[model samples]
Target chain A: MTYCVAIRVDAGLVLAADTRTSAAFDDIRTHTKLSTFEYPGERVFALLSAGNLGTTQNVLARIARDADTPGATASLRSAADLFEAADYLGRALVEAQQKANGAAADGVNLEATLIFAGQIGTGATGLFLVYPQGNWIAASPETPFLQSGELKYGKPILDRILRPETSLEDAARCALVSMDAAIRSNLSVGPPIDLALIRDGDLRLSHRLRLGQDSPFYVEFRETWSTELAAAVRGLPPFEWEAPRAPPAP
Target chain B: MTYCVAIRVDAGLVLAADTRTSAAFDDIRTHTKLSTFEYPGERVFALLSAGNLGTTQNVLARIARDADTPGATASLRSAADLFEAADYLGRALVEAQQKANGAAADGVNLEATLIFAGQIGTGATGLFLVYPQGNWIAASPETPFLQSGELKYGKPILDRILRPETSLEDAARCALVSMDAAIRSNLSVGPPIDLALIRDGDLRLSHRLRLGQDSPFYVEFRETWSTELAAAVRGLPPFEWEAPRAPPAP
Candidate 1:
């Protein structure tokens, strides 16, 4: 399993994914689950994927191939808006799964879920979680985010902290914290984590980072969070039966 | 479905469970999932349950009936130690499930998972997760907690905060915070939350709390956590690209 999340705040979009993939406990591998397509100042789209690795790679290849072909009618570059871009991704996902399942053994699953997040021309910045069925849902000011794969373990922080009014930096930090929860509690969702930031209207990537398990910056981030959280828990109010503290010195 | 967790620390044991139970989304009901049997100063045991409510109730009834009958030979009251108590509960659970499943239509499931936690006279205080198969595992110093049902969402905090050396109050608070995470992120695991704590040498109950969604103490606990967590996230060190700040004014 994998864990990926995309947050759409007013300032920009934050997309993140964990890189671990496994067929069995003994057969684990690291693969990038994040990909980007940018036409600097015209359109920029990031894809965060989860599920069957083969199907995800096939879908990504199709998207890239169509964008490169001159006469290809529907591609990320040709799509008028983010919704159209998501539609193309959904169709590609469905087609890839169908083709892969055709030659697979019975009971094997080849489904994939991809998240499309970026800006297109003058349209508002957006995020969409494209389903395995080729259907999708867009993030709005009210929702402001989308997630796929081993998601529940990391979701409470996102639910509590994200909002349209939140700063781009804060939203990005929230995504990392959310992923940290998943990575710590679950074995299937490991790192190096991939993170991308696309500021609204820039129509280009602002920052892209890969944080391995030993990255100093990432290690500091985790340690700081742990220390702060321990302090926070320590400061919680004492129970009713515990003796009340005297008022603070004047 | 339900969510229940039992934490065993050197200080004693902290046991908690959410009260929401449902056969379908529309068929929700409230039922206590924490049960306690104490022969004050001699022995004490608490049962935290998940899975089929009918089977759980049947097993509890059997335990009660056997304990009340003089010379029934095998009941919570008759068990020699914490492990023996767990064994009695496990056998009762299997018996209950087999009887329920035999009378039900095909495809029906009545399996339950139970955690037996307490101490017997002059022995070590203990916690055991009794399986549907009548086997069990104890919570040791290294991995000091056991959780059942919709457990993943609430697990990260437990991993971060629990230990044998953690104080009884801190461990109890950690259990509440863990329950808070599950209650916020999930529909199936919810309030009112039931909590019970037993001190290492005291055979009788230490504290028993039932926190409803609207309970003032629970509301305060949730709010405090939310506030502290938000502050903690705010205190995280900024990324490299952010402009460096000047020293604080004296």
Candidate 2:
């Protein structure tokens, strides 16, 4: 299980992913789930993946392998727009599925979900959630976000805090808080987070961070959030079952 | 879908459940998932359920119907301890599944979970998570919590805040905060919550609340938590991305 979220706000986009993956309680391991494609001022695309690691890694490897191949149908570099780039990714996923289908006959689903977002040119920014079938949906101002992996645990914070007009810095912070909440609750999602920020129209990565167990900011945020939450809970008026009743027979 | 949680702390026990149920988007409705059986000064048991409402309702109805029946194998009234009551409830769930198996073949899953907690005799209070197959596990100081239905979204807060020494009042407040988080994130878990508190050795419920959309405390808590979380996020130190050197002129 993993938790990955990407937000498309007015300020830019915020992307975050957890590193823990587990086959069971005993077979847990840490693996980076965030992949980036950058071509300086030309294009920048980030992919946060969840589901079968083998399938996602294979899809990513295929995309990277095709980066330098000219006229190879379509590559992230050759795509003229974010939509085309998403389509190229979708195609790569489908191709990978086809190649792995024969060995995966025990009904193990080789599905992988990708949240792809970034800029392809000046004044052009896009965010898309790509499915295992290679189809995708672009995020709109009304939604403003996309999540994959073990998303349910951390969704409420996003729903309540995210907005189209939210600042990039705030959105990124929200993403981290959301991830923090997820990691605390779930064993399958642990430390060492991958977070990225892309300012609208920049066509260059604004921030890429790797937060591990010892990250000072994360430790402080977790402790402070817990303290404030406890305080907030205590501050609420105590509920009474019934208006003070006199003792029956002392 | 549903979200029900029960916590056993030093002060006592806290139980909370959401009311949303749906077969599809258009087929959604509200139903109470928490049921209470009170023998006044003798015992008080609260059952919070999730999954397959039909199955749960059937299980409850069966228990109520057999409450006064003589020699009933494991009726709650006949149970000598809270553990026996939990076992009875789990058996009732299995009975419900068997009774509905034919109907289930048409698509519905005749499965449900029950969180049963209360006091029996002069013993300490106890809490158990009952499975559909007549098996259950009691909450201990080591774990101290149990949740079912759409559980992932709200689990993080519980992980960070819950402890064996947590006060009953504090646990109740934490439970509500957790539910609020779930409601904000998941469409399948909604308002009109069922909340209850049981204090140790009291043999009577301290607080049982049916909090709805119009509840001022709930509304205020939700607003306050969201605001505080956003503020906390902003307080975190910002990521200092490495600056790139000047690129060649176009």
Candidate 3:
């Protein structure tokens, strides 16, 4: 299981993904689920993936290999815009699935979802949720955030706090808080997070960071949030008992 | 879809359930999912259910119908203790499934889960998560809470705050806050809510209240919690940029 969240805020876009993957209780591993496709001055596309690690890795590898080949099928660098880049990536995923489908018939569930977002040339910064079927939906003003894997646990905070006008910094903080809530509640989603920030007009990645368990900022945020929540609950008025019985018989 | 949560605290037990049911987007309805069986000072049991509404209603009606039949299948009143009562309820669920399973094959998805907790004749106050199979597991000191239906959204707050030593009033408040979080995040789970509290060794029903969207206490808690969370986030130290960026070329 994994948890990845991305927000398209007024200031920019914030993307965060955890690095833990497990097939069962005994087989747990850490693998980076965030991959980047950047052409320094022209475009920078970030992909946050969840679901079958094998399928995602294969699809990503194929895209990279194709990009390295001279005059190969549409690569992120050659795509006219972010939308075309997303389309190329989606096709890459489909090709990978077709290659693995024969073996997947024997009980293996090969499914993967990717959140593809970034800036391209001077066109509008795009954020899309690419489906397993090679289809995608771009985030709009009404719904300015996208999440994949173990999303339900962290969705409440986002639903309540996220908006199109939210600042990038605030959105980043909320993303971490949401992830903290999910990690505390679920064992499947563990530490070592990958985060990337892309500003609206910037053709290059603005801020990218990896967060581990000992990351000072994350630790402080978790502890302070928990403390504040407890304090908040305590501050609420205690229920007023309308009827009181005599002291319990000794 | 529904959301129900119950917690066992040192002071007593707290149970809360939503009252919304929907077959799809357009076929939503309101129905109470809480059932109470009381014999005054002798015994009291509150059952909070989630899953298929028809199945749960049938199980409840069956238990009530068999309460006075001698030599009939075991019922809540006929059980020897709280554990036995939970088992009997589980069996009742299985019975309901058997009666409705035929319809299920034709497309109906008949499933139900119940959280049963109460006191019986000065015995230990107990809480159990009764499954659709009629089997159940009692809550313990290690894990003093149980939730059913749309549980993930509300689980984080409960995990962070609930403990065996939490006070009854605090536990009730926590339950409401948790449910509020779930309701905000999930469209399927909504209000009005039913809450029941049972104090240790009292052997009788303590407090049961129904809360709606306009319920004063709920409204206050929701508003206060949101404000407190925003304040807490704002209080956190702002992320320090290691280096200032150069002004973009005009």
Candidate 4:
């Protein structure tokens, strides 16, 4: 299990993912779930993945292998637009799952869900959520974010704070706070966390960070957020009945 | 789907539950999920429920009926301690589900989960989470809370704010905040929340509140929480690389 979120703000896109993968409680491992595709000033894409490790790895590996091969038919570089890039990713995910299931015996589901976020050749910045069924949906103006895997614990913050006009830095901080909430509430999602900021129209990555468990920056972020949240709770108005209580009968 | 939570603090116990119940999108209704059993100064118990509405209603009705009947075996009033009451409630739940499932033809589950919170006689005040399988687990000093149904969205706040030394009012506030979070993140959990507070050693009820959708206090609470949460997000520290960025290449 993992938690990955991508927000499309007016200034840029912010994408983040946790690194914990657990087949079972005892079989947990840390794996990077964020993959980036950059063609310098031409195009850039960041793929945040969650689901069956083998399937995601295979899909990612296939995409990278294609990119490395000169004149490959279906690579991020070959997509004509952000929509086409999402479609290509969905196809790769389906093919990878089908190929893996074909070799196995039982009725196991090797489905994987991904967030395709980036800029494509000066096109409007985009964020698409690719489903396990080889289809995708892009974030709309009203809802400028997409998330997958262990999402609920971290979602309320994003729903409250994110908007198209939110600054790039604020969006990135919101993502980190959201991820921190998820990591605290759930065991399946852990650090190190991977984050990337792609500024709108720049076609170049502004920030790419990997925060391990003991990283000072991540620790401070978590602690400051926690303290402020507690303070927020403390500062809420008192309940109507809080001050006026009936006396206990003698 | 529903969301019910119980938090046990040194001052007392705080329990809350949403009122939404849905079999389908079109089949939604508001039903009270919080039940209280009070023997006045001798004892008081609050039961918060989630899961199959029919099963929960049946279990609740049976518990009430047994208590009304004279000399009924294993009624809530007859239980020796909070643990015994939890055990009795679990048995009632299992009995109700088995009775319902026995009558149904298709493979339908009539399972229900409940949080049994209150004091029994002069014994220790307690909170127990009763599972669908008729087993129960008590909340400890360290954990101090139990939640059921659509729980993840609201859990991070509880994990951060709840402690053995938290005030009853604060605990109730935390419960409301948690419930609000769940309601916002998931459609299945909705308004008209019920809250109850039981002070340890007091034995009688301290506070019982039913917050309807249009209730002014509820509305105020929700607004305050949202505003404070947004402010908290704004106050988070900026990313380390946020200030230093190279200009885009010409």
Structural similarity to truth (TM-score) of each candidate: 0.97, 0.87, 0.88, 0.93
Question: lDDT tens string, model 3, A114-179?
Answer: 999888887778889988889888888888899999898888778767788887877888888788
**How do all the candidates rank in terms of TM-score, highest first?**
1, 4, 3, 2
**Residue A43, model 1: Cα distance from true site in angstroms:** 1.2
lDDT of 2 by residue, A1-250 (tens): 8999999998888899999988789999999999988888888889998988888999988888788788777888888888888888888887788788878978788888899998887746888998989899999988889988777767776787788988898788789888887787777888899999999877788888898878886776677677765655555555664344354354
The candidate maximizing DockQ is: 1
How much lDDT does each candidate structure score? 0.90, 0.83, 0.84, 0.89
lDDT per residue (tens digit) for residues A1-250 in model 4: 8999999999989999999999889999999999998888999999999998999999999999987888888788888888888898999999999999988768666889999998888688899999989999999878889999999988888888888898998899999988988988789899999999999887888889999878988888788788889878876778877675455365
- By DockQ, the better pick of 2 and 3 is 3
| lDDT order of candidates, top first | 1, 4, 3, 2
lDDT agreement of model 4 with the native: 0.89
Q: Scoring only the second chain, what is candidate 1's TM-score?
A: 0.95
| Window of ten residues with lowest summed lDDT in model 4 chain A | A241-250
TM-score of chain B of each: 0.95, 0.90, 0.90, 0.93
Over all chains combined, what TM-score does candidate 4 have? 0.93
What is each candidate's DockQ, to 2 decimals? 0.74, 0.43, 0.50, 0.68
- Give per-residue CA lDDT, model 4, range B27-110, as digits (tens): 999999999999998889999989889999999999999988889988888888877788899999999999999788686768
- By TM-score, the better pick of 3 and 4 is 4
Model 3 misplacement above 4 A: A65-73, A102-105, A235-250, B68-75, B102-107, B236-250
